[model samples]
Structure formats: structure tokens, C-alpha cells
Target: MTQTLPLPVTPLTAAQQTSLVNLVRRAAKTEILPRFRNLSAHQIDTKSGPQDLVTEADIAAEAMIARGILQLFPNATVIGEEAAAKDPSLRQKAAEAELAFIIDPVDGTWNFAHGLPLFGVILAATRYGRPVFGLLYDPMVDDWIIADDQSPTRIAGAGRAERPTSVSKPGALETLSGIMHYYLMPKDAQAKLAPVLPSFSRMGSMRCSCHEYRTLAQGGVDFNLSGILNPWDHAAGVLLCQQAGGVAKMLDGRDYNIAIEEGYILCAADQGTWDTLKTLLSPLYE
Candidate 1:
């Protein structure tokens, strides 16, 4: 039985936007959830290079998401990781599309295969390259996190809400740097991070980008550090963070463009925290 999805309270009313997210969540739960356990082994492959990994579950999950989207919006283009890897031209089509679904069926394939419980299915509907609808589902936890610049929602075992309690802001990085992750920081840089803000705790890394951003939005984490960020990896979560009242940017405080292969990205609850981080990172990296 299909669940009754909540009504959209934001600018997006794309016929079945609510249902679409729910559909993806349900499909993820059905297909990927069962396989979370009882795994004998997983089939894997390399993409772009050996470090980037994809698995059978990732392919199957994206296909499931694509089929659900096409069934609802036949005209909308869908660009998925596995499919786009096989044919690069689809990426061009996605870039040009007025409406396209950008999807990474499993965001943390490494963790998923290892049964570390950090993998998820990520979907974002972009209008002319700007995300309008986004959903990230963790089948392991049975959690569905949804957000759009327009309408953002979280459905969890506890309950559902349009947004969390108002987002929080920390002092500038000069004072708050210790509370955030220092991506790709060298031992010298890492040591400096602690001394920069003796009052706060040093930052840590969550290998899964989606979870890191989610924690940032929820006020549980202060910043994200990633030397190499992927469009599919950060796209949905970035939109969600911005909508949830946080800010995301490159280390230089630049706009995030999905087309870019890598970014020294930072995610904070607000501008002040971002400014502090940017200032500290500037002289060091230079």
C-alpha cells in the first residue's frame, strides 16, 4: 500500500512531488533495505578512477528511482551515476534539461559493501541545474530525509516535519574552527586547528557526505571538510542545507557548481561560521 504523502508547503507543486519522494523512499526501503543484511558478497566496479566505487545495489537502486520518476514525469530527464558512467552524453543532456533528476543510488558504496551502515539513496530534481526537490533515504535506519529550496521535510521513526527547529549559528571559524571538520588538512594544519579555538572540540570526519550535511543542518555538527566533492555526492545535501538555513560554499567562499569535479567545500549552520573557516583556510592553503 502506498503511504499518504504530506502536502507541499513551498513553491514546488510539481503534480506529485511529495509522492515522488515517497515513491523513491519506498522503493529504496523495499529493494535496498532487505539486502542490507544477509549479504554474502557485493559486486563492485570502478568509475572515473579506481578510488571511486559503484556496486550492484547502486545500479539497481538508481534504475528503480529512474523508473519511478519516468512513470510519474515521462518528460523529465533522469541522470543517474551508473547510467551516466556508461554513456557520458547523458550528462550533457542533464545539464541542458529544464527538468532533470540527479541521482546517486547509493552515496557510500564503500561503507555499504562493508556493512558500516552509512550508505543511502540520494535523489534531487533540478530545474535548469538548480535543485528544486531533494530526497536522501537511509534504508538501514529506515530514515527518509527530504528537502527542496521550496519545501523541505524530514520523515523519521519519530515523526515528520517541514523543517527542524530554527537552524543554529556558531562564532566565526577563528573561534569555532575546532568544532568542524578539517578536510584534507595536513598534520601541521590539523594541529593549528585545535590551537585556533582552544575552547571548542576538534572537528571530525564522517566518510558519508550526505550524513555530514544532515548533521550540519540538524545543528549536531558545525562544518564539513572535503577536498574532492562530487556533484551527485553533494548536490542534494547542499540544497537541503541551504534550505534548512545553513550555508554551503567552497573554501574560498564561492558558489557551489555541480559541474565542478572537486571543491574545498565547507558547510556551516550560518554565515559567521563559514567566514571564520574561510579566513583560517586562506593563509594556510596559500
Candidate 2:
């Protein structure tokens, strides 16, 4: 028999946690907020697809956030969406790092670049590819939803007392509502999942996982499904959903890891909801 040792994981000190919150807020104010609705057409660019986008705000904010992270935790790995996009290898490196900070400087760039107020910043800390902590911050709202795996605790913002979060109670499928990224799926997967869309009462995407997860944590929505699997997009939200008394996993039954390259993720408020959704959506992924 072969023996394997568990990965060494360290909890973030109170100081580090507080520093991270401040750093993200400062980056958003200085680099992201200033550039909102002010970017030139040339300042925005596309990758992978026309619907996928990046902007000067994303670039600048990522630089700021990454730099700040390095300064605060010199030994930690920092991976930004822009840099990872440029060099695909960063993703795997982050997945293996003992401590890593994965950042989505400006989530929903398509929305951010188009003068929509739906985008936000996401920061996720992973230890050996598993999320240890997650933060979803909305620059527009000047608030955030933060969680960590140890206690599975979720907090809203500064000075706000930590409160237990619960997802919407399990309900009839026809009465449930959630965010679904239907257009992001492949054509064939879309074909298979289209018929099932109406099984739920309503399905829409805010185009931003930050807001989407925030809404789900607060029970504003019952669930969300994503055909695309980007660690920076889902890692934080996965922890938040889990800590908020919800269920999150790949539709194919695999747990989410930073290195996962392909798989659809379905997150819901509870196990019953998760099982129902997985049963309904499993065929599309398979």
C-alpha cells in the first residue's frame, strides 16, 4: 500500500484577514472604481469569446491586488485572472501551492465594461487546491461576503457581526428561482439543458459571480448553475455557499478544485436542492 501525507494548511491570522479586507477595498476604490464607465473602446479587449472580456480596470485592479497580497504575505502565491489568462501554467501552480490567493480583479468584465453595475471583485484563498477562505466584494455596494472553511463562518462587512446564513428552504421545482448562465454553455450542452430550463420558475444571470454568490448567501436566490469552470469565478463563491448552509459541487459529482479545467458547477442552498438539480442537470455534463 502507498502512503500519502495530508497537505499542510495554515489558518489566516486575524491580522492577515483584516489586512486582506482592507487591501481589496483599497484596490477597488483606487483602481477599479475610478475606471468604471470611463474606459475607452480600446481599453477593453476580448479573450476566448466575444462575450468574454477584460478591461483596463481589470488589469489595474489585479496589479494592485496582487501587489498588495505579495506585500502582506510574502510567501504566498498570488494568481490573478489576467495573468493566468496570459500564462496558463499559473493555474496549476496555484493549485499546488501551500498557500495561494486567487483573484478575479473585476468579475463580469462584459458587464463592467458595458457600464453595468453588476460586476464585483472576488478573492479566494486556496490551500492545496481546496478553498480555505473566500471573499466576494461589490465595489458599488462597498460591502462583501466573506467565509472560511474552518468554522464555515460568513460575515457581511466591517463591524458587522457574523450571522448564520441559510439558503432558501427546499421548495417545489416550479416555484424555485436561480441564476443560470445558459448562454455560456456549449451548443450541444445548451441543447440538452434548454428543455430543463423551464423546470425552474426563473433563470437569469447577473453576469457576475460576486453578486450571484452574494445573493445566494443571503437567500435572494435559491441556486446557480455555471457551464464554465473558472477557479477565480467559483472558488470563493463555493466556500460562501457551503458556509452559508448550502451545497456546491460539480454536476458530475466531483468536488471543486482550483485546477479543474472542465466541468459544470451547480450550487444550491441545501442538499435536497442540490440533489434535485444534479438529477435534472447531470445528463448535460455527462
Candidate 3:
């Protein structure tokens, strides 16, 4: 087995922070936008299956982001969703690297490929396996929801002032609204959770973690449950959620890590909600 090195505890500089956000925007404008609703049949391909997709936009945007990162931080390890799909070993290296970047170029590839406007780009900087900086960029709106170790979660761009944001206050279970990716759960787990759906005020999956995290951080939603916990998918969102005064933990109640992939994750608006939701979902894991 390869040894995993501890992540450096250094924080990102002001210029590095700015460059990370710019990288996402550049990729979206130069690679993603032109391919939206304009993909040739040959430019798209299925990865795991029909529901799991990869397109010219995803590939091109990831390449663009990867290049930008290497240019700015030449020694940093860049692990992109598409590239990881092709080479699974890269994920392990990313998890162990002192300075690493995880990129989900097109987070909602299904929605994007189908011409839906719910897709977005995600970038996370980690030391070892812990997230230190996160950026969630929406191309259509040209805005970024960002967070770092030194700052609370905030939104910027589109000529608007950067404003701090937080998670919704905990409400009664009957009045709580959240997203759950039930379909991604195991059959037995899904069966166990089926009856728990109507307990929430609103329960639905947006098929996009980017939007779900945005909603949670902006106080638009109370909680989110993800059956699949890939680093590229959850790393940035989890950090942003935590920075915005929320709680994110694995089913076993461990802190979210970039190397984790098996356990489910529950990110809630507050600790009270997290405790309640964990108890509610305990049956599935039990």
C-alpha cells in the first residue's frame, strides 16, 4: 500500500483565491457555454450508464480548468471528474497530496446534456484529504458561491457585492425542506427510506448537488442527503455548507473527507436538524 502524506495546513493567498474563481469562469465561457445544447452525438458519451453521462462540455471544461490550475500552481495535483473516471488511481493521489485540487467541471452533466440550466462547475482545494477552499460557479448566472478556511461562505460576481450567507435555521421536521438523492441509494436502503419521505415539508432531488448546496447555503433549504459521496461532487459543497453555519457528516457521524466514497452524507442547516435527520436515517445504515 502507498503511504498517504499529511496535508499542508497553509491557507490560500488572496491572489490564489481570485485565480481559482477566475479559472472556473474561464472554463465555463471558453469551453462549456458554446457546447450547451449544441453537442454533436459524437461529442457525448455515457460513462457508467445512460443516467451517468460525459459530454464534450465536461471534457473540455475539465481540461481548461486543469490547464489553468497547473499554470498558476504548477506543483499542485489536479484531479478532475472526467480524468478520474478514466484513471481511478488519480483519486488516491489527490487524497494524499499536500496541495491538491478537485474539479467537477460539469456537475450536472445529465441536466446539461439535456439542455437544462441546472448545471454548474465545482472546484475544491484540499490539503491531504481535508477541504481548505471551495468554489461553486453557475455559468448561466455568472455568479460564484465561495468559501475558504479564512472566511464565511459568500456570493460574488455579476456586479454585485460579495455578501455573506448562512444555512436556514432548523425548523420542525414537518416544516423542513430538503433534497435527497434516493435513487442513488441501495435497493434495501431505498426501501427503508421510502416511508420517511413524506415526513419532510418538501423532499426532492434536483439531480444537481451544486444547486442543492447553493440552496442550503443561501438559506433556501434546510438539509440535503446524498447517497453517493464522491470528492468532486461533495468536497466543495460540504465545506461551503459547514462554513455557512451548517453541519455535514457521514452516516457514521464522521467529518466529510475527500477520500470517502462509500457512506452516505447528510448536510443540515443546524446541529439539531442533523441529529434528528441522522436518527431518521439510521435504519438504512443499521
Candidate 4:
């Protein structure tokens, strides 16, 4: 397989750019916000099991996004989380497409359905499997953390400036704070990593990758680890982290690719912290 290089990206025009942000806000206002804590039993369905869920809000928001993307960029492929769940091949198609918009309409479905404000919407624009732009939108706060090839990561909202953001500084492993969502890992891998949790000053999972990435990009956390490597979940986050002067790679130390799923991924504040994290987690996969 050939490696995909991060080439210079064509920046979206001011209108085109704002359209993406508006898409997220529109979905949140029309589809997501109305259903938060308001979903009925009929509105929820299990994908793999009880812990793996899909809600009406997810479907509605994804549909809205998909429609909007096709309308705005007719040539661009739109691969949404819910749609890809129904047809796994769409995931592969998106990775291979020349221009694609990958959407995670409701990233933290469980939290949203349960009235938790931890959920968010994620959008990633990829050119031939390499992310060129990423957006993580928090509806509760109506803020967006955005990153593109042309600029550093930044936060934008109604009353706030588009302030540049970066990752937290690297710290000793024992003093580092980060997120590790262990439940998504294989049983044996979980067992292997269980004893290593105490090595970090703080080790927890927010059950929300969107927020996890937000925490990392805004200098709120040192690193983030995950065993599940879904494109919708990590593509935008990883790009945002990288643009924020952080390092993100597979546990095996390869750069992240949307085509690969099912591996450990570590995104950290800096190269040193990334190396330390990979060293600590290598044993689990070894």
C-alpha cells in the first residue's frame, strides 16, 4: 500500500467555510437540540448491544448534513456515521474518494440521549484519505474548534474571537493528564492496560471523543488514547491535534489513516509525550 501525503489543500472560500459551520449549527438546532433528553424509547435502537446505541437524533442530523454537503459540494462524497453503519462499504469508499466529507452527526449518542451535555458534532474534510480540514462543534456552548491545513487550530463562537489554540505541554507520564476509553478495547488488551492506568496523574474516559479532542486541542489535556479507530471518531480529532502542534499516531508509531480501523491510537501534546505514550502502551499489543 502507498502512503498518502498531506499535500497543500485548497482553502474554502469565506462563504464556503462558513457554510460548513452553519451546517453543523443548523443540524444541532433542527435535529440534535430538539431531541436531546427528549428521545423516546422508539427513537433509540441498539447497533451491536446495549452499550452501542443509535438515536433518532443521530439519523436526523446525519441526513441533514449529508443533504447539505451534497447540495453545497455536489462532487464531494458524504460519508456519515449512521449511513456507514448501514453500509460498511461507504467507509472504504470515503477513504478512497478524491474529496469526501466525513460526518459524525452525534458523536456521543449515549450522553446526549441521557441528557448529558458532553456530546458534539464532528466534520472532517479529506482529500484522498488525508484530512485537510476538521471541525468539532459543541452545541451546548455553540462553539466550534476548527483546524485546517492553512492555519493553526482555533476556537470560534458567537462572542469569542477566533483565538488560536495548541495542545498542553508534555509532562512526565506520572504527572500527565489524559483520556483512555478502555471499554472499546479488546478484553485481553483491556486487561493488559488496566494495571498501567495508575501511571498517569489522571486517566479517565469522557465517553465522548469530540470533547476528548477539544480538551487536547485547547491545552486542557496532555494526551488521548483509544482502541477503537473509527474514521468518524478520530479523523477530525487527529487532524485538529496535529494542527494544534500535537503529535498523533497509531500505537505502532505509524501516522493515522482513515482506511485502517481496529488499533490503538495515541495523540499527545508533543513528540516526547507521544513517544512516552507509545512506549507505555506497546506492551499491550506486543
Ranking by lDDT: 3, 4, 2, 1
lDDT of 4 at 125: 88
Please list the C-alpha lDDT of all candidates, in the order they appear: 0.68, 0.87, 0.90, 0.89
* Candidate 4 lDDT tens digits, 172-246: 889999898888888888889888898889878888889999999999989998888889999899999999999
Query: What clash pairs does model 3 have?
Result: 7-128
Candidate 4 Cα errors over 4 Å, as ranges: 1-11
Name every residue pair that clashes in candidate 1. 173-276
Tens-place lDDT per residue, model 2, 99-166, is 99999999989899989999999999999888988889989878788877865646566567766666
Candidate 1 stretches with Cα past 4 Å from truth are: 1-11, 48-51, 152-166, 172-200, 283-285
List the candidate 3 regions with Cα displacement exceeding 4 Å.
1-10
162 in model 3: Cα distance from truth in Å? Answer: 0.4
Extract clashing residue pairs from model 2: none
TM-scores for every candidate against the unseen true structure: 0.80, 0.94, 0.96, 0.96
For TM-score, candidate 1 versus 3, the one ahead is 3
Global lDDT of model 1: 0.68
lDDT of 1 by residue, 183-247 (tens): 44556666656555554455666567667666666667666666655567677877777777778
Better of 1 and 4 by TM-score: 4
